[model samples]
Target: MCNARGDEAQAVARLGFLEWAFTEPGQVTAETVKDALRHPATKAPGSAAARAFVDYLRQAVTPLSAGRARRGRARALH
Candidate 1:
């Protein structure tokens, strides 16, 4: 996910999210992700920019997560 557009703060946030998501089983909820985004350490670099970046990430990831959940359920039924 690293790219030129992603500055150090954004990279740190993303890494933190990944760590949180993988550290525990079933810990990747929207609320948890938002919590990580708003975390003091993660937001310390630049609150406004981090907030905006996280908002964008929320919009993009939420639907994909929902869709994945739905697909997992569908597969279970079959």
Candidate 2:
């Protein structure tokens, strides 16, 4: 999923990102992905889901490090 999709543009972008990551591991972080991202399809979250999403975000931050890790779960919203 982190990699690009099947398209010339995406593949080119993916290759560039990969090269950057390899050459500059320190700089190529989550921010790199965030920076490359522009006007993501999903809208920003709001207070409507805060009660449930807050804690979920806190304890549910999964590391991007390579290794096996189970996904975290949040309390039921309802």
Candidate 3:
């Protein structure tokens, strides 16, 4: 049980690092990260990993959509 707990803690820490690393300068800006993830035009075709990074972005943005919805509701009430 202790080993499992340690593994879970390590996983959480790694995720936090990734979240910070992926964030853009001065903000948690995913668009900036997305732009950085793109391959150079000189490359004939982007790598499979680059395409996967973009797919991750699409999935990640869904939660942000709900945050926006909450903010809009707050504004409407004012």
Candidate 4:
């Protein structure tokens, strides 16, 4: 049952990504995320998953826009 649920969730996510890609081709580049995460520094201590999420977000949005979005997220967290 858990496996089935996970598969369904993954399918939904995949469809959503396809829609997003079609809507905004400029975002969601592997290079963008990689560069964003690697740039400035990588020394911030955290779980591997957190670091991975940062990289994923960087790649998932426009560079400038993502930076602004991240700032908002940071403020919200605080």
* lDDT head-to-head 2 vs 4, winner: 4
Ten residues in sequence with the least summed lDDT for candidate 2: 50-59
**lDDT, candidate 3, 1-78, per-residue tens:** 112234454554356446745664676566654554454631332444333434444454445458788899999999
| lDDT of candidate 4 over 1-78, digit per residue (tens) | 112234454554456446645675476576654554565544462434434434444546644447888999999999
User: What is the overall TM-score of model 4 with all chains considered together?
Assistant: 0.31
Model 2 lDDT per residue over 4-60, tens place = 233543455445445645786575555554443333321353333322232223322
In candidate 1, what are the lDDT values of residues 1-78, reduced to their tens digit? 333244765566566546646784775676766666566645543454454456555663565448788989999999
lDDT agreement with native, every candidate: 0.59, 0.40, 0.49, 0.52
Q: Write the number of the candidate with greater lDDT, choosing between 3 and 4.
A: 4
Off by over 4 Å in 4: 1-4, 25-28, 31-78
TM-score of each: 0.36, 0.29, 0.33, 0.31
| TM-score ranking, high to low | 1, 3, 4, 2
Off by over 4 Å in 2: 1-6, 25-28, 31-78
- Backbone collision count in every prediction? 0, 0, 0, 0
* Candidate 3 TM-score, true structure as reference: 0.33
Better of 3 and 4 by TM-score: 3
